[model samples]
Target: MRRVIIIVLVLLPLAVLAVWIGVRAHRLRPKSAIPAGTSATAPGPQLPSPSSCGAAGRSQLEHYDRSTVYDWLDGGAAPYLDHGFTTSTVATYRFETGGRTLTIEAAAVRFASPRGAAAQAAAETPPGAAPVPGLPGAHSTRDVLVWCRGRDMLRLVSFTPGAETSGPFAALARAWLGGTAP
Candidate 1:
């Protein structure tokens, strides 16, 4: 009986640790922002094609609606949800510049009205971000750009720090905005 108790004491902790790890991994697993029964290729807002923005290949777009925005934005979804966010489309593009490839993530959020988009943009703009040249309602920093066009608010972020102000970043933003006519 003593030997059995000792064995149980040793194995119990290992079993508990295994279960903990499993629970943690289940929580951390990527959640699908797309709603069930909806096709991923469902028609929606048009983002600039990767090739048009000088990217190596096409981008795979993921969409999120008001119900599932948190799966994509996590804690950052609150402000968007509060501001009448309707839908959002996100994509990642790889651009080769100066012999180095950079990954840029872009998200286009549509609101119920132009007012909602403007409000969200203004709320997200930092104190000293410079206005993007020739793009009304657009602001930029070293690694991020936020812009609003009519009922849509578009954001671009560079995974590699300090690449936000690069030429490729601006070109991609411009291409997207040009294609997204009000």
Candidate 2:
């Protein structure tokens, strides 16, 4: 009986974790096509091209040309790119407001489907992060925001210590996708 109780205790958390992952995967799965000829120029449900990644141009921020390629993301962010990572665009900006200087880094990643992108976003989100204000269901890890729209995964990180950046990150996310994803 003691052995049985120990086995149940050991497996319970694993089972719960599996269920949670499964649910998240289901929630982030790609939606079905809207059918052909439904409406022209309504913005196709297809993934946005990496070349079309919008620039972050808020007045409070100074845009910088410090973009890097895929090889640079091979370290901590490599696991999140497991699902059909085609291309990515990155931008770094500096925000100075109210006697505070904050450095912001944004990356837009293109995946095969929204599910892949959302899964990547979920994978990158750390525990205790909350959903960003403007972007619903998007998480913020104190200094970073992770979100997905259509087939694009967007990440915004504040490089400055103790910088509160949920609002700016949301704005950058909007700018990166030209208003919203798809």
Cα lDDT listed for each candidate: 0.79, 0.61
Question: Over the stretch 97-176, how does candidate 1's per-residue lDDT look in tens digits?
Answer: 88777888888889988999999999877778898777776888878888889998888888788654457667777888
Give TM per candidate. Answer: 0.72, 0.57
Candidate 1 error regions (>4 Å): 1-39, 180-182
Residue 55 accuracy (lDDT) in model 2? 30
Best by TM-score: 1
Candidate 2 lDDT over 1-182, as tens digits, reads: 99999999999999999999999999787555542211222222232222333332322212111122233453544554567666565556666556776677776677767888888888888788887666667788768788888787777778885777765666566656574442
* Full-model lDDT, candidate 1: 0.79
Q: Supply the TM-score for candidate 2.
A: 0.57
Worst 10 contiguous positions by lDDT, candidate 1: 34-43
Error of 1 at 53 (Å): 1.4
lDDT of 1 at 97: 80
